[model samples]
Target: MTHIQIGCNLSYTVTQTTSFLFNIAAARTLQQTIGEETLQLNPAIHFETFTLGTEGIQVYRIVAEPCELQLQYHAQVELYPDRYDTAEIIETDFQHLPYEVLPYLNPSRYCESDRLAHFATRLFGNIPHGYSRVTEICDWINANLDYQAGSSGESTSACDVLIQRVGVCRDYAHLAIALCRALCIPARYISGYALGLQPPDFHGFFEAYLGSRWYLFDATRMAPVEGFVRIGIGRDAADASFATIIGTAALTTMSVWAQ
Candidate 1:
């Protein structure tokens, strides 16, 4: 088991009454256990913590008026991820896929799998099936795309990253997910804290449904897959965004760490 300590501090300037929905807490799963954690808000505002969907994703909701909102979160997690032999992990047939895994095969806000179908087939059609094929997809992305920190924006989609060939960690995952889905593979986005990430911060990775389960992959190749601590899982980045503000607010500072 790997023990990791993760946390983050965020400062926001609220101009008006704002509702902040934060998905920064470590997810509750049998694979990982939270040892000690704390969530604090300056001024001691009222906030509620709740779970979302079947992933046991934890979300923090806070309503703050015009003020300097400071949020702090810290946690110690023990990861016990499932281990599988790559060579033996075969792809699951569409007709046999579970109901919960079907949605990941379709297109979403950031992943335009429908439009990239032909391109994906042409690029990956000749590759052997199963885990190796997915690895090649990630390898292709890591080799071709330039990992520039601010090369893309929130509005950027998988197609945009494909054309520009430049993106950050999330963009890499978005493109990989789109391509995998286009190839009839069930893939999904994952938001988490990654150890060994340069200039450490929250990281974006993905999982491809293979065999009878999902296996994690990182197209960015920026961090060790075993060191990942999942926070949220969804069809795309939209569903797993770290922060969503309902009113006017500007993020002034953010510091994240995972060790």
Candidate 2:
């Protein structure tokens, strides 16, 4: 088990009536345990706290009327990651895949698996199957793309990253996931706090379904997979944004940490 402290501080200027939805709270899973947590607002505002499904993504929702909104979140958690044989693992056949896992095989807003299927076959089809092929896909992205900040925007997708060959962590994960799915492997995106991540902030990674379970993979290799604390899982970034705002809101400042 690895112990970690992670959180984010954000200040926003709400010029008009706006609603904010947040998903920054550390997730609780069988492999992860939360010891302590605190979520605060500068004006001592009231917000509704709720959990989404069984994912343990705690949501903090609030509406403000033309005011400076300051938000802070801190949590202590221990993460437990199970080990698996990456080289020996085999891919699950489509017919045997669980009904719930079927959605991940489809193309998403960020991961255009359908469009990239032909490319995936030509690029990686000759490689051996299963985990090794997936790792090769990860390595291909890391070697081809430059990890440049401010190189991408909110609308960046796997195809965009593929053409530009420059992006942050999520872009790396998105492209890798798209390639994995294009090759007929079940893959999904995950948002989390990565211990020992340089320039510490929220991180994005992907998980490939192998054999009978899902295994973690980070194309960026910015942090240890075992040290990652899962926060949200979804088809892509659209389903896992840290914050969503309706109406005009200018972000004044932001800070994040994980250790």
Candidate 3:
């Protein structure tokens, strides 16, 4: 098992009553466990904690009046992800897919599989199927796309990234997810804390369901898969943003770390 210490600090200037929904906690999954952890707010305020579906994604909701808000979170996580051999991990047939896994095959907001269907099949159509194909998808994305910080915005989709050929980690995952879905593989988005990430921020990765399980992949190749501590899982980045604010607030500073 790999043990990791992860945390983030967010400072915001609230000019009016603001409601913040934060998904910054380490997720507790079958392969991941959380040890001692804490989430604190300066001038401690009442907050609601909730879990989303079966992913074990924990979210914190807080309402704050005009003030300098400081939010801090820290955690100890142990990861023991399942290991599989590339040749042994074969793709599952559509008719045999689990009920819950069906949603991932369809197009989502950022991962528009429908639009990229022809392009994906044309480029990766001849590649051998299964785990290796998925790996190649990530490799192709890493080689083709330029990783520029301000190249993409919240509205950027997989198709957008493909055309521009420039994006951050999130865009890499989106395009990979879209390509996988177009090739009939069930893929989903993941937000997590990664070890060895150059800038040390929350990382974007993806998972493709194969051989009766979901295998993680990082198109950016910034960190090892086992070092990733999942924070949230969703159809796309839209559903797994670290912070979702619904009022007047401006983020003054932010810092994230994982070791």
Candidate 4:
């Protein structure tokens, strides 16, 4: 069993009535045990809590007036990663894949698998299929793309990242997910607090459905996959954004930690 402690703090200034949705809680799963979770609000505004998908991606919604809005969250949990043998993880044909995995093989807002089909095939088609093919895709991405902070915008997509060859962690993940899907490997985006990530902060990664289970892969390779604590999962970043403000709000301070 692995124990982890994580915390998130944010300070915002609101001009008028603003609504905010937060997805900064540690996901509770059979593999992870959540303990001592806490949330603090400066003005103590009432909030409703809900979860998305079967994994219970926690979301908290609240509305407050013009004031210094401060929110802090802390949690302790344990993560247990499943181990699989490489030789046993054969690529399952489309006919055998589960219904949920089918959607990930299609295109999405940030991961345009359809548009990159030609390119992904021409470059990676010759490689042996299964985990080897997926690894090649990740290797190609790491070698070609330059990891530059603040290089990509919210509107950037997988094709854009391929052309520019530079992006943050999310961009790397988007490109990887697109290529995996083009090869008929079901893949999805994931967000988490990387335990050993330097310049510590929330991180983005991808998982490919291999054999009969989903395996994690990080294109950035900045943190050990086993150390990642999942926060959200979706086709791309659009579904996993940490925060969404409906009205006017200026973020004055933000901090994240994993220990």
Candidate 5:
């Protein structure tokens, strides 16, 4: 087993200064098992509450606030532990919890679930009921999608990327999730920080389940390697958003940097 230190820094460059509602600041770690808590070192900088969810995972949620919105998160995990490697980790069944995720997984008219299924079938065909199929899906996504930033944003959907054939990490993750769900595979979106050598220090990723075990996959980074740090998980970006507010704010200029 190898122990590693992972850190994620996220910042938002606002075009203007305005009051913004922020959430997802709450940070929690998940252990190898659902019942245990993964060790977390540094606590959140500015947060409203820190609590454990029903699944026994740590969570951080922020409330309405105003600022330049520069946030940094750091955590350490034993990567590729003797008990857990990429193959071993991803080969297990995903923990099924559709009851907890269905409401959030519902698609809108613009991105209907049925439409997504048809689109994904063009590439993945009928979703295979095995790990090999899942791996194939991942490999296919990596092979087909080009990893470029600023191609798409928060509202972009899988179909949009399918047509354009270009997108950012979030777009790739959304595309992957849509494809998995279309196959009746329960999948979820993950929002976290990825260690990069450049700015926008954090990136997005996704996870899917085959049966009971949840396997982590990063369509943005392609795979979790040395510098990946997790922040949050939900059905999609809508559920995993870092900040949201009912009121309006003019975002003037925002900047994010990480290394």
Candidate 6:
């Protein structure tokens, strides 16, 4: 077992904060299981209501009164009883899972001749068979893709990142997931905090399932290390955004800090 700590500092400035709505908060760890509610030690700066979304993703919604707003928040996560050997158990649990549990695995969404399959075939060409293939793919993504914060925008597609050769963790995960789903493998997008070494900060990571077990693989970090905290899981990044506001708000300045 291992113990890890994670922290996040998010800050933004709004042009006109008319009822500022935000969704920035830590997610309960998977160790706590689905549908379980637990208090976090580092609370959010503003009061927010928790909402559950598909695939165990949590949403924190906060509404603030109108004003020129500069908002900042920090979160810390301590992961305990960290057993990395859950791969076998995860595989076994899903071996006999009903189709209802994984409707996204339906091949109808990705026809046999679809681009997803083509991409997977290309990626799988050099990889040896079995779990090693998944590992190789994850490692390849981590090594090939550079971690840049604003390289890609919200509207960027998985294919776009593949061509650009640069992206954030979410882009890498999306590309991997697209290929995995095309190959009839079950994959999901994960959003959460990764504890940084210097001063501490929150980043994102992802996990994928091969055969009977779920393996945590961070395309961003590439290697299994300490301080990876999970916030939510979903089909893709669109399903795992920290906050999505409808109206336009110009972010003038932002800053983040952690201890």
lDDT of each: 0.95, 0.90, 0.94, 0.91, 0.55, 0.55
Error in Å for residue 184 of model 3: 0.9
RMSD of 3: 0.8
Task: Looking at model 4, report the run of 10 residues with the lowest lDDT sum.
Answer: 81-90
- Angstrom error of the Cα, residue 218, model 2: value is 0.8
lDDT of 5 by residue, 60-120 (tens): 4443344445554444544341223434333232345546655434554223456777666
Better of 4 and 6 by lDDT: 4
lDDT score at residue 153, model 1, on the 0-100 scale: 95
- Model 6 / residue 229 / CA error / Å: 1.2
Model 5 quality (TM-score): 0.68
Per-residue lDDT for 120-228 in model 1, tens only? Answer: 9999988988999999999999999999988999899999999999999999999999999999899999999999999998899999999888899999888999999
Tens-digit per-residue lDDT, 1-259, candidate 4: 7899998899999999999999899887777778899999998999989988898689899898999999999999898977767766778899999998899998999999999999999999889888878888989999999999899999999999999999999999999999999999999999989988888888999999988888889988899888889999999999899998999999999999998
RMSD of 4: 1.0
Q: Write the number of the candidate with greater TM-score, choosing between 4 and 6.
A: 4
Please give me the total number of clashing residue pairs in predicted model 6. 3
Clashing pairs in 4: none
Give lDDT: candidate 4, residue 174.
98
TM, every model: 0.98, 0.97, 0.98, 0.97, 0.68, 0.72
Deviation from native of the Cα of residue 224 in model 2, angstroms: 1.2
lDDT of 4: 0.91
Off by over 4 Å in 1: none
Instruction: Supply candidate 4's per-residue lDDT for 200.
Output: 84
Candidate 1: residue 181 Cα off by (Å): 0.5
Better of 1 and 2 by TM-score: 1
